[model samples]
Target: MAAPPGCFVGWQPLLLLAVLVVLQGQQLRADFGLPTAVMGGNLVVRDANGINGVLNAMDRAFRRFNPTGQTDRLMQASAVISQIALNVTELGRSVAGSVIKAASDRSTPVDELFAKLQEKYGRMSRYLDSEVQNAIETLNKSIGSAQSLSLKNALNSVAAAVRQITNSTADVGSVIARIHETTSGNTIFKAVDKASIPADLTTSLSRALSNTKDQLTGLSRTIEGMLKNIGTTNAFLARFDQTRQATEKNIVGNQQGVKAFIDGEKDTTVKRYTNTRNAIIADISNAVGKLNVFGTNQTLLALYDKHSEEYTKIYYYLFNRNESDIQNISSAFDAIGHNMEKIVVDSTRSVNSEICYNKYSGQVINTFPGYQNGVVNCMTREKNRLGRITDVMDRMLQLILSTSQDLANNVASCTVWNGFDKSETVYRQAEACLHTNINEMAKFGSIIGRELDLVQTLGDVEVAASRYRLYDCVAARNNEALATIYVLNKDIDGCVSEPGLQRDVLGGGEKGGDEDTEDPYEAGASTTEEPVYDEYLMEVFSNSSSFGDDVDKIM
Candidate 1:
């Protein structure tokens, strides 16, 4: 009943037994299958986590990397541009001030001219006074004469003629002074006051008084003609006042209009530029923040594998957004371009207005002095004529007053000074000074025009520089963003291709099971063979072993 040495009675057939053991091993391996899925899931999850982490890291790096430093540098450059623009503006202001001062300096000549006019008017006043006195004396002498009837008629005619001349002289003097006052700041008054009067008024007044010796010159033709001349002079004076008033009013109105335009332009232009620059800075900040948030290696890797499509979409979206921001920046620059055009137009208007004012001033300055001189000369001639008449009357009157102590002491001994000659000389000198000032004012105006042109050119250059500098910075930022997008896309693609990610996340296929093998007893030749051990190795193994006999036996 004992089993053979290599076989037992309870043992099954070799093939069946081998198959059973192999199946058992297969079952054991199968028992670990869920763990494999878990491990695979862990690998996929790690891959996703790693990708996300890398992307986040990259994003952090990008965000942390400050481009603001470059932006600050650009801003500094803008400040430099602003400084240049300010310099140009200041230059323009300086030129304008200089020109204005030059124009005002012409007032010196104008003042001198006015003085000459006053002197001429004074001489005429004195002449009229003397003529009135002479007429009174003549009338008195006639009344005392024995040829009373004829003498009375002659005295009356002389008296009437004298009154008419005095009246006309008074009217002329009043009109001339008013005209001079109205154009006081003008140079022409000096020249006119200095020059000689024309023959017409002198000849007419002389003739009118000459015939007055016969029957009280009944409103003589000469006096009437002199009155007509006075009327003509008054008309000219009125016209001169009107012209100056109108010019001044126009200049004031134009200056106000230009000031309003310039203020509006500055406000609008500065607001537009500031708003645009702020908007651009805000957009750049946002875009950069976004880049920082999503540009990490981990996130890019995760996006590369699991969400490549989304990654691509986001990348392009950011790119397009940045491009849109750049376009907006360009539009802002376009607004600045419009501002530049407005400034140029305003500058042109200002220059033109200044030039126009200067031209009008020059014309007024040139003409008024001569007009004043002529009026003065007229007054002077009238004065001289009246003086001769007054001189004759004074001699006759002196005979009457020779007995009075006060008359003898003050009036007789005192010289009758004529102011006409002195006034004429002053008028001439003043007129000369006015001429010089007018010429200088014209030169200053020309210089101002040139300075304005230079300022405008400098302003244009500054605007161009500002626009170009901003454009360069924006373009550079846009290019950088685009490059980042490209890099992120590549990283996402690589992550998507990894085998670890494909197997676990994609659920493509299961792993192979453990294989079966032949039964050891059936395949072996000997069942009782012992493994050999060396005694020296056994002693060394025994001395070092904690499980003494078993380890020693195995050795």
Candidate 2:
């Protein structure tokens, strides 16, 4: 008559109910204790008086009726069932009255047992529901605390970066304002005042100005030292011009015949003329070399080293006082661009050579516009300088050959006529034009040498000014980047503000219109333009072609 371990002989309902209650209690224990298994969210309530406990007490009462299977024993089972029914009412009130009424209607052991287990399952579900609620509350609190700490740390990082950027901006503004103050009537200075400048900016400005002044003074000293060399070169060329004219008249005027004069002048007048020509060439070469801009351009230097013995050879340059010589020298002058390439390289290095924005690659990209613009200004100034030099050189070449036309026509008959009278006429015209050409060349070369020195000095100034402007430009860029970061930390869509970042960096530069901006070298057009020679020297030669066939062969 006894029930099985998990089932009963005729007590199926009670046995099934007890087993299900135990199984459900274990599941509730797992659910309620899940927080402890992971991060320990501190859920306090456990399965102490849950439905499993109530069922255990009911099982004991059922066993008491096991020995006496009589009608009176049904009262004992009912009493035990009523106790469970009360527990269900308190825990799950909705099913309390229904469970009790269903048990009373059947009054049989199996029917009452089924109603009891149903009520116990409901009680256990309610207990788990309460515990699960507590666990969720604890989990929410933990998540909130963690999120707050993360947000705070993020804000702190952005705050620190913002503070650094703000200080840098102040230092940069102060430096620019100080520059403006000293540059009274200067383009940028006119727009800013001391009242608008921050106190910290003044200190940085003072240091920058002091350093700039020192650099400028050093340049001034360098120029002052070069002035003596320039004077020496000018004096040498002046004396060489007078000596060349005297030598030409004495030697070429006394030739006897065409063949004897050519043979005789080769060792005397031609040798002296070759020496004077080479000397002027050396002077111009040395003047350009002293600049140290381009170390040594061999191709340009080769034009000056023609031998006196090979004076009439077409292969040589200065020996041919013909159109070919003009072309050769022009090619050499064109090669001056190779020398000026150094100015471009040096100016680019000066503006953006150092790695200032190491933190971000994008910031490095931001510096390129400034570097490019600076180089453009430098090359423009240098290009104009080259134009002026060539302009004066062009005028010199035109002046030197201005009187060659009449001589060419007069000598046209000499080539046909063959005598001392014909030879002397050709020789005199050739000698006169050659002497005048050499004198004028020496004078013009001296002027170009002086102009080259001025151009080099102005090029140095352009590089320095570009470097200063680039410093300001990059500082503005870095500051703007930091400010954008600060805004991004606080806002989700911070990228919207980044489009104008580079624009803001170049804002200060836009203030300097083409005129003010183009002249960062501080040398205006009128300042760098080549000056005219004295009227008497400029008008010394007639606008006639005098480089006749005899003049070409004599050279």
Candidate 3:
């Protein structure tokens, strides 16, 4: 007697048996190492035939469904469908993973197969007789549902449009009513005697009344037509109320979201930047103070004094009785003054006499070869040097005196009086005062920047809220219209499936049956015939496995 067709004999059975044994071991481990040898034996006896039968049935079904002549086409189609399903599943999984990652630091992998099932087959497929056929049916149903939703949405949209028209009409009516009330209340019309009224005025008033009456009549007709088309005004109002409620809810939610986002940004990013800016300002203030101290250092003051003395001597030599020396010195003095003017202007300071003297003294010492040569020209080098020095000294002294006079004038003319102090002390106090003012300005700038940022954030929030409110109304109306469209599509689909349309398309009875009997797959049979799968699957599977391993290690 021959063994049953599905009975496994060699390494195949052994491999299956090994897998079963491993599963049994896992089960035993799960059960706290309970003695499961007898249970394993029972599993083998109970499941072996059923497993073999299922495998055989799968093979037979594949052979029947996928014939040799059409294997490639069917396989390619299946692969494409599977690929699409996988891609959709992966997209859903990624979305879910992103949501989860945002909520928690953990990465969770959703089952691709489950996601595919949900996306392709839907919940109704599980109860259907054939999963594939039910999948098709579910697709049809979903299309129907979508169509119904679209029809409903369209109706709602029309209703909304009608409501808008009605509102416009009401507004026009209110305007007309106001005009009528105003005209009726006017005492001029009542006081004017019919016989005594000017003919031109009476004619003008009658013409205006006629025009107004004509406009009101046209408006009334238009309102009546709109009301008839969109059902009663009361019905439109009821639908508008529903739409308004939905819109309000959506607007509130969006407003809250915008508020939360603004609050979070202000607390985190804005505040951090503000603090950093404040700290920078404080550091800058300290740096400015250090610069002021350096500017007034003893070494700097000594350098300035030497330069001043040289400048004073040069000035005295230029203005003395020697004619030849006077011309040369005057030209040098002018050049030095020009250069000093340039420096003071470049530094954004006024051309005060003290600044002029100091700057000219430095420039003369640096630029004049004659001053150095004269130092060596005299019989006694001391005399020539003394002469050069005295010339600079006289110029500097004149500049200093001029500067002093200006300062004294300014001080004496001032309304606010403080105790008298030395010039050096006053200069230091002025430097400190300038530094304080600069610090205050920087602080004010930082405060203003922060205030502007706050105002901008508030404006952004308000804009977002306003946009949300407007779009919410549009969305609510659109959703309702979508629902109406869905109903209309259902009606159309039902009409198509009815006996009349079905007979036209599918040949329900005997007429034109030959056309319907022809095979749909006949034309393409010769061109396509080979086992095929999507090339991308192998790569995807490898990548997925690697990713899974990495995740497992991390967990």
In candidate 1, which residue ranges exceed 4 Å CA deviation?
Answer: 1-227, 235-259, 291-457, 460-555
Candidate 1's error at 491, in angstroms? 96
Model 3: how far is 218 from its true place, Å?
29
lDDT of 1 at 93: 27
Location of the lowest summed lDDT over 10 successive residues in candidate 1:
546-555
C-alpha TM-score for every candidate:
0.17, 0.19, 0.16
Candidate 1 lDDT tens digits, 20-113: 7666544432221111122122232232233233333323332332222222322232232223223322322232222223222323333343
RMSD of each: 72.2, 38.8, 44.0
Rank the models by TM-score, top first. Answer: 2, 1, 3
Summarize candidate 2's per-residue lDDT along 55-165 as a digit string, tens digits.
344334333422132122222322322333333224432322332232223223333343453454344344433433433233223212222232223223323322332
Residue 179 shift from truth in candidate 1, angstroms: 60
What pairs collide in candidate 2? Answer: 174-201, 402-544, 403-544, 403-546, 404-544, 404-545, 404-546, 405-544, 405-545, 405-546
Model 3 / residue 394 / CA error / Å: 60
Question: For residues 102-165, what per-residue lDDT tens digits would candidate 3 score against the true structure?
Answer: 2221122123222322332222222222333433333223222222232223323323322332
Highest-TM-score candidate: 2
